[model samples]
Target: MIDWLDFVVLSLLALGVIFTVIRFVLGPKLSDRVVALDTFNMIIIGLIVFLALVFDSKLYLDIAIVYAVLAFLETIVFARYLEGKNNDNS
Candidate 1:
């Protein structure tokens, strides 16, 4: 049987992803959108970790670690691109 706590946790995570997506879409500036994207990635990582806990599996944990590294790299690359863009505009 499914537990009520599971529903609550999942609902909250879903809400987080939703809100971040909205921010990314509606943000006035590129930086705000990037930050929203980063937040969305973090929330996905949280969901993966939650899955690891729910399934009692280490594989999900490893996936989460790899995802985190990639997400960090992605954010860094985007930041560099934005930096270069801003420099060109100035």
Candidate 2:
């Protein structure tokens, strides 16, 4: 039941995930890797939402919401850790 537009969007999302993975792996700094991980989480949320739409299922959207919340919390923790590290060096 998926249309061409849906296919295109999914393809783009996949490509984005691939590039983000590269960034995550090759990032020279902890912050860069954290940013890439955050971006990857967002892309995964997008994929979940899109899949929910394509399959006409609300469950996927609910999962996406939970995942987004977790990702946000994780990002905050990472930020705090980085801040603490910086303070220790100062």
Q: How do the residues 13-84 of candidate 2 rate in per-residue lDDT, one tens digit apiece?
A: 999999999999999999999999999999999899988989998899789999999999999999999999
Error of 1 at 35 (Å): 0.5
Tens-digit per-residue lDDT, 1-90, candidate 1: 478888899999999999999999999999999999999999999999999988889999999999999999999999999999999999
- In candidate 1, where is summed lDDT lowest over 10 consecutive residues? 1-10
Cα-based lDDT at residue 88, candidate 2: 95
Which clashing pairs does model 1 show?
Answer: none
lDDT of 2: 0.95
Distance from true location, Cα of 84 in model 1, Å: 0.4
Best by TM-score: 1
- Which regions of candidate 1 deviate over 4 angstroms? none
Candidate 2 stretches with Cα past 4 Å from truth are none
By how many angstroms RMSD does model 1 differ from the true structure? 1.2
Q: Candidate 2, TM-score vs. the true structure? A: 0.89
